[model samples]
Target chain A: MDVILLQLLNGLDKGSAYALIALGLTLIFGTLGVVNFAHGALFMLGAFCAVTVQRLLSISFETIDPDKVDFLGNPAKVKTPYVESWFGPEMGGAIVDWSVPIAILFAIPIMIAIGFIMERGLIKHFYKRPHADQILVTFGLAIVIQEVIKQFYGANPIPTPAPDAFKGSFDFGVLLGFDPNAVIYPYWRLVYFGFAAIVIAAVFAFLQFTTFGMVVRAGMADRETVGLLGINIDKRFTIMFGIAAAVAGLAGVMYAPINSPNYHMGMDFLVLSFVVVVVGGMGSLPGAVLAGFMLGILESFSSMNVIKSIVPGIDQIIIYLVAIIILLVRPRGLMGRKGVMED
Target chain B: MLGLEKKDTSLLIIVAILTMFAPFILNPFPEGSALAQFNAGYPDLMQRFVIFGIFAIGFNILFGLTGYLSFGHAAFLGIGSYSAVWMFKLLGYNIIPGIVLSVITSGLFALLIGYISLRRSGIYFSILTLAFAQMSFALAYSVLTPLTNGETGLQVYNSDPQYFHSENMPNIPHLFGAKMQGTYSLEMGPWSFDFNTGYYLCAIIMLGMFYLAIRIFRSPFGLMLKAIKTNQTRMNYTGLNPRPYTLAAFVISGMYAGLAGGLMASMDPLAGAERMQWTASGEVVLMTILGGAGTLIGPVLGAGFIKYFENIFSKINDTVLHQWFAFLPDGMENFVITIIHPFVGKGWHLTLGLLFMAVVIFLPGGLVEGGQRITAALRRRAGRSGRSGDDASSTDTTPAE
Candidate 1:
């Protein structure tokens, strides 16, 4: 029972990222009909925002202090860093320490600007082109984005840790009347899960409750009809594109501790997210979140000792196997509407 | 438009003959001259020309005729390469048996992949094929280390269990005049030529494949594939099954990829998992598009252009740039080098991306369309001076596509 709860906790954090990414992907696919192969790159860019901000605040220049002391017949020089002088000690250290949370403000405008430029520059021309053309162009865009990142950051993964405040794990098992260490869960992971749930809820609430969300949803249902009604549906879709980019970006920012930021991290998310979207049924937002978490849990459970003993490589491909089965069994997916990707 | 007649056909034949003798037509560069770097008449680049030509041609057959954009075709090519390398390791280094084995291996693998993937169509089909290729890549990277040699890649080394022993087997195979960079140089003052047998062998094989592709394009099956591409649902409604035709196209293209792969290993026996990767697969698609998808000759031209650019771009350094800008002041020369540095070598990809965007945006029909537009513009200026052999471009990149 304790093991089950611990694994469940583990699954929720991973599932949060998948749900967030998949939700953003479905939003773009549903509204724009572009598939947006570069969404994963957007996600990658989100994490890099954190890396950039961290580098900005934490990067320091070493300087020799004017005062010197001699000890044991050797001249000793005091060492200092320029950041202390620039940001004034405590505040600078705090800014550097809290780069992850600070990146949220930095990531929003950066990601929105990126999303707007991408839609305006290349994706606008491909609106009437074949799905293959959309795929080809977007794929090329993904590669270019990744290569640019690689050029800037190099290929290796850059580790980013959660702030020091959330370092320790909570003794949830003991609180639940079980052994102390049996169901140990990290506070940061719990925070991540909570954050993901809040974001997911907020997005759903915004879409389901607000006027803007209603218009976007209506536009998704019928862009032509909405445009005929003189609503500036294209502009709305563009905003939705920005929103989707922010969602993916935030997911990436939050997921930095889960997996270190690398240029090729986007490629890894790409196909898997596609599978998640397909399994949930294309254009279904809720379905994407549900399927994302479901696959994530399945993957986690498959990696367990009991399951691995039964199937040697189940963990490696459980999600894909589930996807193939779901797709084969129900071509429209669990919550897919008719005529979406049916053509 | 050449009246679609015999006189135009003769002109095309003449052009083909000239292209075949391009080595003789090109001005020879002096040995160790700066211009020597630009001379792609060398055996190494020639081998790539034939191999990638075959790869692009095979891809064209699928994407061009069927309009089924497969982004994972390199899996077959990689399989072919692996099989050819195995043949060389197990059998002798003779080209014939290795080529035969490669074709068979690639064919079988393609058939299997095609059979499974062809169950879906459009985006689903693309995704399925990509997934399968990625799976192959992952398997090769991890579990299939014995066969693929894992990250290190497979290569020829030491003694094999040769049935005829080492004494009888000549290390490499040869055919016609050209050899695979086997012989160094036959110099004549400033000019020199090295013959490669493997390249000649590949060239002959390519010629044969080209002939086969032309025949296939003219066949009933080819017409059916074109129909499938235009209206898959309509074809189904007409009681014509599109599966067999699509599967056949897939397999045939797969075999072509395999043949290219076999040639690669033959040139230098090394097979790596990277060959089967998604990016590698995507490169073939790029080659096909850049050349003009459906056209027979376009893929070869595209392949040559890409490979040549890749070679030239990778070779450019700051020093080379400075030499070119020697007339400038030292500061200006350094500035020029800095400006051009990002576009050279691996950075050549930046140039490729820009070119790709330009091509896709302006000329959706690819290079063929660009050529036709150029011809049309010229014809307008010339005031119907000569017969327009430009019908080839229109036939290749039909606006209806």
Candidate 2:
């Protein structure tokens, strides 16, 4: 029971990331009918946005402290952040500590602007192009974006610590009446899981309740009919694109604290998210989310030492193995709508 | 002469002539000159140009003809390399058996993968292939270490069982007795040319493969594959099974990739898991698309261009850039160098990405189409009165659409 619960929690973190990215991929595919290979770059950009904010917040000036002697036997130089000088040391220090969370607000507009520009500028020209062209162009864009980030940040992963409050692990096994140290998990992972749940719910709710989302949903179902209804479905779809980008951005922003932000991290996730999207069935939002979690749980379970000992490398290929089986047995995928990319 | 049509025969002759004298053509600059860095006539790079040409040519047979954009063709290349290296380790250093086994094994692998992956069409097919390739890569990188030798990569070691080992033979991969890396540098007054046995051998194979690709493009099976690409439903209604045709194309391309990979190992005996990664797969796709997918000569041209750019452009550093622009004023030169520095040397990938995007966006039919457009426009300007001439026969030799 402890092992299962532990794996489940572990699964949720990976599932959240997969679901979030796949959700955005499905959104773009469903609405604008573009297969966005560069969506991952947007996620990377969002993480970098957090990095940028942290850097911006902590921009500091050096001054010599006469009280502290340096290693060279001179007065020590003390660096004070500009935020500390501006907002007073305590408040500014607190803000710096919580920059990763605060970056959510900063990334939203930037991501939305990026999405709008991407849709309006490059992707708009590729709307009538072949799927191959769309894929190639976006892949090229992704490479360019990652390369730019690599140039600025270097190739090393940048550590972005979570808030001090969420630094420690929670003993779930003890909470559930098992041994104390049986199934301890980091607090931030739980926070990430909760955050993903809320984001997924908000997106679902917006689509369910709002007229704009209804039109967007209709557009996904039958684009011609929605367009013939004298509705400007394109504008709504563009806004949906922005929303999708924002969702992916927010996911990356939070994930920065979990895994250190690296230029290639988005690419590493993108491939798996693509697998999740395919296994969930293309353009199926709920299917994507469902498969994301299912695959995540499956992946987590397979990675167990017992399973590894049995299969001797099953963990490395379990997701793909499962994907192949599912795709062969049920071509449309679990929870997939009829005739959505069936051809 | 080789069972080719008149136009194809001429193309074959032209390509043959070009490959035969590549050392001369590629090495335009004099020895020890500043522009010598731009020369790509070296054996290693020349081998790559033709080897990748073969790979791209094979990829084009499927993607260009059948319109099935495979995102995992590099797995076959990796498989081929592994098999070839194993042959070298198990058998003697002779390349014929290694190359033959590589093609056969990769063909079988392709047959199995294609059988399953072809169950779906379009993006699903691409995803399925991608999944299989990624699985292979992951397995090779971690679990399959015994067979693959894992992170250190499979290489010819001193302790490997060499039942056919002889004191007189070279340790590196060889053909019968001739060393693959043997090069004879001819120093002509100003220009120097390196004639490598390995490059010539690869060149011959590439020409043979190119000839085979030409024949396949003109064959009835090729037309059938193109027909499927045009409308699979229509072909099915006409009582044609597109499955066998696509599978055959897939297998053939896989073998081509295998042959390329074998040749790669023949030149330098090492096979890494990175060869099977999706990025490598993307490269062949880029090569095919950049050259003009369906055209007989396009893939080769694309392969050469990309390989050349990777080799030559990457060699240009800020120091070199500064030297080139030293004729300008100090401030202006420094400004220009700084701006230009990022897109060259280690930043060549950035330039490549930008160039790839521009090509996909602006020239969808690739460099061939771009060349055709220019020639057509020039002809129109010269004649001024001809109704865009039925020269479509010349330009549309192999239709990409």
Candidate with top TM-score is: 2
Quote each prediction's TM-score. Answer: 0.91, 0.98
The 10-residue segment of model 1 chain A with minimum total lDDT is A72-81
**What's the TM-score, to 2 decimals, of chain B in model 2?**
0.97
Candidate 1's docking class is acceptable
Docking model 2 quality class: high
Reference contacts recovered by each candidate, as fractions? 0.10, 0.71
Write candidate 1's Cα lDDT for A29-92 as tens digits: 8998987778889999999998988887776765544466466544565443356667788776
DockQ of 1: 0.41
Chain A TM-score per candidate? 0.94, 0.98
Measured against the native two-chain assembly using Cα atoms, what DockQ does each of the candidate structures obtain, in the order listed?
0.41, 0.81
Q: In model 2, what are the clashing residue pairs, if there are any?
A: none
The CA-based lDDT of model 2 is what?
A: 0.90
Compose the digit string of candidate 2's lDDT tens values, residues B331-389.
99999998988789888888888988998999887888888889878877766775555
